[model samples]
Target: MTPHMSRKTRIAGISLAAAALVAAGITAGTAGASTVQAPTADGSPLKLSASHRAELLRDASATKAQTAKELGLGSQEKLVVKDVIKDADGTTHTRYDRTYAGLPVLGGDMVVHTAKGGAIKSTTKSTKKSVKVASLTAKIAPAAAAQSAQGTVAKSLSAKKADAQAPKKVVWAASGTPVLAYDTVVKGVKKDGTPSRMHVITDADSGKKIFQYDDIRTGKGESEFSGSVDLGTSKEGSGFTLTDADRGGHKTLNLGNSESGEGKAFTDEDDKWGTGKPDDPQTAAVDAHYGAAETWDYYKKVQGRNGIKGDGKGATSRVHYGKNYVNAFWDDDCFCMSYGDGEGDKAPLTALDVAAHEMSHGVTAATANLTYSGESGGLNEGTSDIFGTSVEFYAKNDKDPGDYLIGEKININGDGKPLRYMDKPSRDGQSKDFWDSSTGGLDPHYSSGVANHFFYLLSEGSGPKEIGGVKYDSPTKDDKKVEGIGRDKAEKIWFKALTEYMTSNTDYKAAREATVKAATDLYKAGSPEVKGVEAAWDGVAVK
Candidate 1:
């Protein structure tokens, strides 16, 4: 294998093959309409002051109808409450889904902000346009649209393993105009039995392929420091199964060393399973289960997010996929994460960071819904890496102390080397440490280096340093030194930017702006955190 290059399948997230399908959105600069005291630098829980009670109470009284009117959703449109989040300072961010004429409106989701006392603040929307459709009727037959979508997938795959289901009709507001469209999922096994999953949306009126995305994200993940963790198991008729009933019924399935098959649910006489070896399927399951559990805990405890979709639902995990497949992927269609055994089944890609990486993709989809191609795609991938690394640190497992090096444990290249480096991404040869116009032409994984570098610089600062017993040497394009803001504050800033300020089509420049705004919201406009954000972006040549 080439040094600093990965030969293993490295599919990490949903790949939006077509860029036009991304939701058009209005970018909100920051989220500080109602001022609240900033979080402590020590990462303590935010405490709302009693002084803000009046504002909080007033904002809490704002109804959905009022919110709809504030957002300019016409009478034909309806706002459905998805979630309501109250911060430590009694600030609220109410998320909602939109429907037009009783049909689901794609890209019409938005979040309404208000002060403690129900004083309407500002609105953040995936799309600024009103949800109004010209017609609900479809001229093209569903079958014809499915067939057309299949033809589009057949151009790349020889095997026919399309999802055996009918397509659903929905309004596609990704473009300026809302059009009735048919959404189809096509899947097939390649000559090597590797699977390909793609989502195809066709215009119902014209039968033209409107948008398509690849769901088979390939990559390898694993590590030894994760140690052991408690897993929630379900009791079957006579034994216990590897199903986490407490975490939205998340189950881990064994693929029996093949690429296809429903396989079997792992069960044992006692819940204490796995011998820490690939020879035992339960070993991988143990790691997978532990990783999923820890990831869920991290989001819930730290970010106050419920599950991957923030809907208190869990996605399944499949291990031992294929014959030494050397890759892992997350399938949104099935709402499951699948992992392959490394060469000779000696290594399973069930590491902690890998598990978090895959699950974080689902979170990105639910929140920013970032397009998985071009600059937006790079941000999407980088966002996963940031959260994945964050989850690793949050776990605080002796076996795997948090570090910025990605895939360090799995050694996908078989050379005992990490898959990617955040401190100096250019060390990977394929990844660029700084941004440039040509970045959009690179693969999302490689293009993601810019953001990864920025995050590292922001969290740890530029130049040589040691963190968590790991040594790192980070340099800047401008040859400038940056002071660290600490990971806790940095992650909070990034997460706020991603969830509140960013949109589906956010690029590198926009990401810089969003992070600056996020820092300002959390630490004030001229605080050190905001300055750190600007310095990190400048170090990455993103300005």
Candidate 2:
């Protein structure tokens, strides 16, 4: 369904509303509360003391014996706790990496959820197939594997000084038989000045490259809301620089018109910056700064998380990267977010949702560390979309309100259409409306449709719906109706599932189980929330 009646009319209305708000000098805050309070039926807040909630969320039991027993692992299977998170109800979610015989099992990680009384409740596995390999021995040496991977990457990129990191022994089990393999990283600089870090999975038995992906994740974003924003600045020498000391010291830099080099730090005579247009280089910086602040506020106030890594540290934002580059990305190597001017310098991709989307990649890296391939990659992308939508809503800016539509403000497609539709993902042509084995072959951005649809259904249910003045029509794979548990509850459940129950290699089925476990932990067993999660997953054909 078309989200808005007319893009021009909506933009004009939004501009008018923003003008009126600014004229009245109204400082309407976001819809998010300062404290974390799970909502009850009738919209009443559950009052849990801060100390009590902390106590409940901190206690985690991750003994190897306990995890093994919870996962029903055989005598030959060993478990190592990768991470642990406890919910507000004292239920602990422990993620484990599996080892068979003596080799690390790839794609064999799982999560075990425990109830308040420390009883195992449910377990989510990436692959239901048992962890067992015939042999851990490899015919090919690590040196040979590394050389082969380096050659493969060099040929692909025509790169110079291409070097492959030492190969690590791991079991290859996503498809086919479980066999020994060497995971290698071939690092080099591309002809376009972009860095390339190719993750090459080579079969140790044959020295063949089984799988590979470019480590440099690329994408795009923009800043359309809060038309004229006030950026935070820092005093340097006799001038002010675009560095936000207040919001974890997030600084914005210019990459000039080239793809390389740290261009320059935006500086001004006064603390004020930007004219809300690309004519002023600082405008993109302003949007990036505001986005970072708002996203930080959203996590801290709503989720009670201090920062991306909960370490109270900030990341840098680089803008004006490449000539009409048309993309933005979060680089874990630099712990920063970068944006490119789209088409012309007119579209600087620093929109709230875009910024939130890119930064969320960092959060996923720090939390579940979802591998950027197959179903886990799709979940990773969907998690970004979920939080990006949440952040837009949490900001509640007059220019941008919370909606299920993504990339609506940024005309990335040049047709004024949003990048993806959450309610009906198939509207994008490439995105899937339901889960299927073939989804793993699609781009993560496209394969994310199933989970995105599930989130939308969980938030607004199936069938005709209007939210934030936008129209939507959602359909289920099974033609079954779904009842929403509200976006507030849905986001909470997703966040819990992401931080608690999800592991690196979680697939669509595992995601279904994780979200169900999250709902059960937050709400109760057999509650509407739990039932809603199941129904939503069913709507996405996950079952």
Best by lDDT: 2
TM-score of 1: 0.80
Clashing pairs in 2: 219-328, 220-328, 221-349, 222-349, 222-350, 222-351, 223-351
| lDDT per residue as tens, model 1, 1-543 | 212211111112211010000011000001112122346432222323223433443444456777777666789788776545566555576666777777777667766766767777777676766566677898999889878878777775665455524777877775567777887877776544457776787888988887776666554355444444566777775667777767777778898886766668987765567776566677788777777887888787677666786666788989888875666777676788777776666677777777787887787776677767678778888887888887877776665556778766554456887778888888877888999999977777788889888988898888987766678899999999988777777778887777766766578998998788778767777888899999999999999
Candidate 2 residue-wise lDDT, 1-543, digit = tens: 212110100111121100100000001112223244464422211233345434433443225775686567877788766555555555566666788776777777777777768788777666677666667788999999999999999997798658899999988766567678998988886654456678899998999988876656554343465764545566777777776666677777888866666668887765666666566776677777777878888777776566676556778888877765566777788888777776655667776777777778888887777888788888888888788778877876776666677665555456787667888988867889999889998888888888889988998889986665688899999898998877788888898788777877788988888888778767877889899999999898999
The lDDT of each candidate is: 0.70, 0.71
Question: 244 in model 2: Cα distance from truth in Å?
Answer: 3.5
Clash count (model 2, backbone only): 7
lDDT of 2 at 367: 73
Model 2: how far is 386 from its true place, Å? 1.4
TM-scores for all candidates?
Answer: 0.80, 0.80
